[model samples]
Target chain A: MAVILITGGARSGKSRRAEMRTRAFPGQPVYVATAEALDTEMEARIAKHRARRGADWIEREVPLDLVGALVATDGGGARLVDCLTLWLSNLMHATRDWEREVTELAAALPRFKSPVVLVTNEVGLGIVPDNALARLYRDAAGTMNQTIADVADEVEFVVAGLPMKLK
Target chain B: MAVILITGGARSGKSRRAEMRTRAFPGQPVYVATAEALDTEMEARIAKHRARRGADWIEREVPLDLVGALVATDGGGARLVDCLTLWLSNLMHATRDWEREVTELAAALPRFKSPVVLVTNEVGLGIVPDNALARLYRDAAGTMNQTIADVADEVEFVVAGLPMKLK
Candidate 1:
């Protein structure tokens, strides 16, 4: 049971690389998407991403409660969470009890039966945000990434669409 | 002091409708976005939404603590939350203490000072999901919508891009 955490900067091709890595595992790939299309442009973008996913990919669009989603996919062979950064952002945007949620996700990861690839963004490299809310997001995302990274068996950083093995 | 709760199915043009409604108010609008782009597609979606918003619109992308976001926008006029379903979904996905987050959000709505529009999705309209996670999302979304509708001064349901006033 290997849980891999993939992190990178924006437009760093982290998702693409993560998807490619999923193919190396034995069973059919399960993709857990953290996206919700709120507009036409987003709808179009979602369409494009869907088109790109391999024919063998089983798509599960769960905008909330990924631990539940993961539990439901208990028999999965290979699982890939396209991005943890968005999950973190979504958590930061919705719940007041963020710390508890992070703790829950951390505890839930080890229970997965299959090889898991968790994707996230490196928010610490960017300039510090001016507003309190932005600062909060940056801090929360950075912390969540750190926590997830500590749990996974392997942690990889993608830069300019290139994957660099960190651990 | 109207407190409107806008609920609809996905891609139902509710956000655009909310934007138009906010413009009818006197002061500049406050757009509270609860989304963060975690991939290329999401980044594009965020950019597109940003393009549509005017300079007068004070954009605050609050991902987690919506009650706190509403509190900050207390004196700000015509506050429009792009969508609460997404926010609720985010909280559920991220936090272990989802009950507490939901309670806080429900408790904070009435305390809002300016006229507010709460945007969310009507997830109860769909068929029951096959799995436990999907069922949980459906149930949680239904509960959150019911809670907001109970306190809102006006509730509107959007279908095929048309708004039907409920209250």
Candidate 2:
């Protein structure tokens, strides 16, 4: 299995770029979503995303156990994790052992049957949060992205919807 | 059902307070975790939270279909959703229609057979984000908390581990 990690700031068009990259793979692509719509505006936001993705991708809304989903779908075609920051945030909000899950994901990647493209936001460039939770999220996502990058066969940083290969 | 919404910054003791408040309710209290550990530090953090929660609470890790889980667990006992911001973040990351889930949650609240304590972070109090996605998350979460508060029987804001009843 081959793993690629993608990172960029919010709305840098990382997801769109990741989508385009994943479609090049030989098999049908699977999109693992980590978002939950909680309001009207969010409803509209989700609608926009759906309109963009269309119906080609087999979508799985695995917000919490992305690792498990990734492992299960490892043999499928190409797999794209839309964003890791939201996944990290979800981990912080509910589970206590988010680190273990990350570890498991890293360990399981090489064994997976399909090529993987992991999408995440680079959160360290921003100012330190004033509160504990924000700070925790910032640090955690930063570290998680770093770990994924370290293991990934390719690392790309997106800027203004442009992808720049770092490794 | 007696529904209360808790809002706070990270580590402001919202979880602790939610736990304490739910302790007042009879029967087994349920902790609906939305987190997925993806790294070492996050694993440690999850472990710490687990230690604090002990084995008394029946834990259900529901990262995506939270409203459905809430619906299924309604009559079981008191339910505590550790945080809404993370839930919303998950929705935003995965699907485009996170608002549908929010509306479903709001609609499901009154029919809950047990008291529900919905916890969320007050992220909008801080400065606006520099990008579109961050700004979207902030705006969506803020609006979500407000909508949940409007429906809750009691609403509280937590700062530095202290809770101030807002409504």
Candidate 3:
């Protein structure tokens, strides 16, 4: 089992790159979407991603319980967790202990029998947000990224549709 | 002379990396600062950077007119533009034509006799900003980065105090 982390800024082609990596592995690909189409903006974005990723993937909308979803979908093809940031947001919104959830996911990643490619955003690279919540979220996001990247077998930082290997 | 672009998220150690690059060139390194300490938060950050950078280098505070400043300091050692994001924000606040300024800077970079090391932020990697102004700024920052990167001889994306060469 291989745990690969792909991190980048918004629209940096991280999802596309992760899709390519996930497809390179054998078996039917799994698209573990952490995003739920809550609004038109999100719906449109999800549609766009699906259109590009094709319909062959076994899609699973696992917004919060990512570890459980991955566990249930084990022994299959590569699992591409389209993102972890949104999952964090969802956990926070649901009043779940995000830190614990993130830790659990990191702990479970190495034990998986199938390949897992996780996509994440680099949110803390910009100007500090004015609101305290945004600040907290960015900090949490950065910490989560570091933790996952540390546990992964490989890590890549993407920019302008290019992936620069970090590990 | 080489034009190098170092980009990353907030607190990603971009300044340290840029400083090392600037020192690699011969002569007294010039620190071209685009930041103005208008508030306590900024003042603290500026102080920290100055402490790390040391007082041995020649420093210039040029929030706007970066191209002119670079041209004026042509024969000096490598000029490190501490950041382009603040410069962009300053231009936007001053009602200056930022796109034109960025274009001019890009065009003028190759002609500089001194090596130039620029630091910039990747603001668009996180979730879409709730405010329209932040969104516009992030979009502008992204475009500016890509434009500058296209002209840069070397481009590096820093993450968690690590630099990953993009070019």
Model 1, position A80: C-alpha lDDT score: 88
Output the better candidate (2/3) by TM-score. Answer: 3
lDDT of 1 by residue, A1-167 (tens): 78888886544456777888777899889999887777774587568767877567888887768888888886866888976767766777777466777788889888778888888877664345566776777788778888888888898765433456789
Query: In model 3, where do residues sit more than 4 Å from their true spots?
Result: B1-121, B125-128, B136-155, B158-164
CAPRI classification of candidate 2: incorrect
How close to the true structure is residue A36 of candidate 1, measured as C-alpha lDDT? 76
Predicted candidate 3 versus true structure: per-residue lDDT over A1-167, tens digit per residue: 99999998776678988999999999999999999999886898799999999999999998988999999999999999989999998998899999988899889999999999999998875566888998989999989999999899999987855688899
Interface Cα root-mean-square deviation for all models: 19.2, 13.4, 3.1
lDDT against true structure, model 2: 0.79
Clashes by residue pair, model 1? A65-B93, A84-A119, A92-B63, A92-B64, A93-B63, A93-B64, A94-B63, A94-B64, A101-B95, A101-B96
Give me the runs in candidate 2 sitting further than 4 Å from their true place: A1-167
User: How high is each candidate's TM-score?
Assistant: 0.49, 0.52, 0.62
Candidate 3 global lDDT: 0.91
Judged by DockQ cut-offs, the docking class of candidate 1 is incorrect
Worst 10 residues of 2 chain A by lDDT: A122-131
